[model samples]
Target: MRKVNEENERIKRRYLKYLKAAKRKDPSTVQKAADGILKFETSTNYASFKKFHIEQVIKFRDRLNEEISKTTGKPLSKSTIATILAANKGFIFWLADQAGYKQRVRHTDADYFNMDAKGQRVASAVRESPYPSLEMARHAFNYMPEVSEIDQRNKALFAFFMLTGARDGAVASLRLKHINLIDGCVYQDAREVKTKNSKTITTFFLPVDDEYLTCFIEWVTNLRTEKLFGPDDPLFPPAEINVIDGAFKVVGLKREIYKNANAIRQAIKEAFTRADLPAFTPHAFRKTLVKWADTHYPTRQAFKAFSQNIGHSSVITSVSAYCPISIEEQGELIKKKKKRNEDD
Candidate 1:
């Protein structure tokens, strides 16, 4: 049995390169597309693309419906299924135009990659996720124990995320000089920071002043004065793991930065779980910020700047993606309309 498809692999590499260079897609997005294609190929027993049939897509979709999520050990969510389906659909759509595949595969067959209408609705429906309120998140930070230097760094990471609404990747790549305490802004220089789409933007400190923001500033100050860390050093430096008594142990801290967002996410998950709160991924903090802005901002321009603070190019992009009318909020609006009708 074949473990790999050479022809498919060659085309996949080209497709991924196209996605990255031409489409300007992030690594995560490209990775998902690659994973989806790999999964489909494996499911088809590494069948040659030249021998493809529409029936294979139908079979794959049915199999996907019955698949369980690796993380939760339950059936995958509609959103997850939808994303995978879309990836598969896109690959086939693109594949249909390829040299050998043009005759074997039909472009219209890719339509079979879509979920049913009801399934599509379920996949697209917005659901309320638990995000810690500003006050609660502040309390969580205050409550965080910082006996160790590594602990201080971890706490500061959470505080920085809340204060700046920075994406985790950018946070991991931030340097001390990127921050200007006097100006109260972070300069996400694309040359140094892992900004989305390699965008360079300046994000001002949010109005969330208190112990949380104070703690972050103090940590940076301590790094500069006490630890003598330079302007180029990481804001929340990586943990220094040492071998203690022939066993690995987390000791103090290092000047190194995380290679990626995984450590940041793990720390956030652990922090929330320890706080007895539902897990809110780092990205969820952006939603929390948007929700906070919606109730606080008086004018559209103010709200638009709030969105720009998080690195969005436009206000509509922010509102459409992050600040949807939540289910509970929709209910409240409906109740108000009912009362107005009764008054009339």
Candidate 2:
């Protein structure tokens, strides 16, 4: 069987470039769009984009419906299906406008790639995701052992996350200079840190338990005084591994930054597991912080500041995306409002 069509590959490259340069999509989003197009090409046996048809879309949808997820070993989810279809649909629509393919592909035929109304609803449903509460986060931080350098670093990392709801990518790339201990703020300079959308963010240390701030301060002091680390040194450096007893083992801290957030995530997972709590991703901390903000900063100006602290441009983005009220909490709020109305 033919592995790939040269014409299709050329068109795909152009489409990906358009997504990045014109649509201003991030790398991950562009990669997803690339994957979606690849999957559609595979389904069509590497057919050229000019050969795109409504029947081909219908057949591809059927194939995706019967496909299984490699990670979960289950059937493909409706959301996953919808995402893949949407990518292909967008590509087909664009192809219809292109010079060479304009006569071959119909603009309206791209609409056939869409899932039914019921399927769309299922794909777009807002389901609650599990995140550690503030208490649970504090418990996890307190439980993290600080016996060794690695242990101390891990504990500090957790405390830092609690103190400022910065994303994992930003945390992984932070330098000592970026954090102002006196000001109690983290300057996520996009030029130096791997921030989301390359956005520069100034995050003030959130009002949380004092213990978390104390832990982080001590860790930074140790790095500066004991380890002789400079301002440019990583806030949380990677572990130095050496062969011990004919086996590779982590011995001490390395004076280098992490290549990515994978190590940071593992450390967080281990810490939570050690604390007998569910391992939550660093992003979950944002949700916890947003929820905390909702209760403490009820006023619009205060809430907006809190949102901006977490790198959100708008308060609505923070509330709609992160601080979803639980069903139980929603009911209690409504009941409280009813009592207030009756009193008035």
Candidate 3:
């Protein structure tokens, strides 16, 4: 069987470039879309996408539901199906409008990619996630042993996340110069940092009383004054590897930030696991920050400032994305409001 359709691959590449340059979708998004198309093609044995049929779409939808995740060994999730279907739908819709295939495929055929109503609900449903509370985050930070460079880095990683509530990618790309202790903020300069939507924002230090922020400042200062690292040096450098006798050994750290956020995510997982907590993803910290702000800051201006700190243009976006009130919590809050109304 043909491994891939060259024509389809070429057109897909063009579409991906369009998504990146015109649509401004991130590389990760483009990659997921590309994977979805490739998976569909693979299932069809790389048959000409120009001759795609509604039957093929129907078959793929059913097949996707039956498929298991290679990593998790569990059935593929509704969210995963949603993304894959959306990708394929987009590709086919674009192809249907282009020359050569315009006469063959109808744009409406793309609608077949929609999952059933039940499936769509499952795909779109928001579940109450298990995120670490601020207190647990503080405990994790304090529990981290800082005897060696790696330990210090791990401690600093947890500390910095608590202090700034910055996304892992932005944190990974930060430089020593990006932070100003005097200003008590980290400026996520878009040109230098991998921020969401390439947003440039300043994160003021959180009022959380953990001194890990101080430790982070001390580490960067020592690296600059004592180690003679310049302003451009990575804030969180890579682990140092050395040849000890014959075996390769990790001694301390080398001056380099991670090329991406994967390492930081793994380190976070390890930290949470060691703290005897369920593994909460780094992104969950964003939700935690929002939850914290909601409890502490009641004024509209305060919420707006909180939204800006997280690089959101509006509070609505932040609320919609991160401030989902869990069903149980919603009921409890309603009961309290009712009780207060009765008293009034």
Q: Give the higher-lDDT candidate: 2 or 3.
A: 2
For 1-344, candidate 1 gives per-residue lDDT tens digits of 55988988898898889888989899999999988888888889998878888788888888888999889999988888888888888888888998888988889978988899999999998666677888767666666779888788889889888888899999989989998999888999999899998999899989876666797888889899998999888888888888999999987667877799898988887788777777778888898888888878869889988988899999987788888887788899999999999999
Residues 168-208, candidate 3: write the lDDT tens digits: 99999998889888988999999999998898999998876
Q: What lDDT is reached at residue 167 by model 2?
A: 90
Residue 76 miss distance in model 2 (angstroms): 2.0
lDDT of 3 at 343: 100
- As for candidate 3, its clashing pairs are none
lDDT of 3 at 272: 82
Name the candidate that leads on lDDT: 2
Worst 10 residues of 2 by lDDT: 47-56
**Model 2 TM-score?**
0.92
For model 1, the superposed segments whose C-alpha errors exceed 4 Å read 340-344
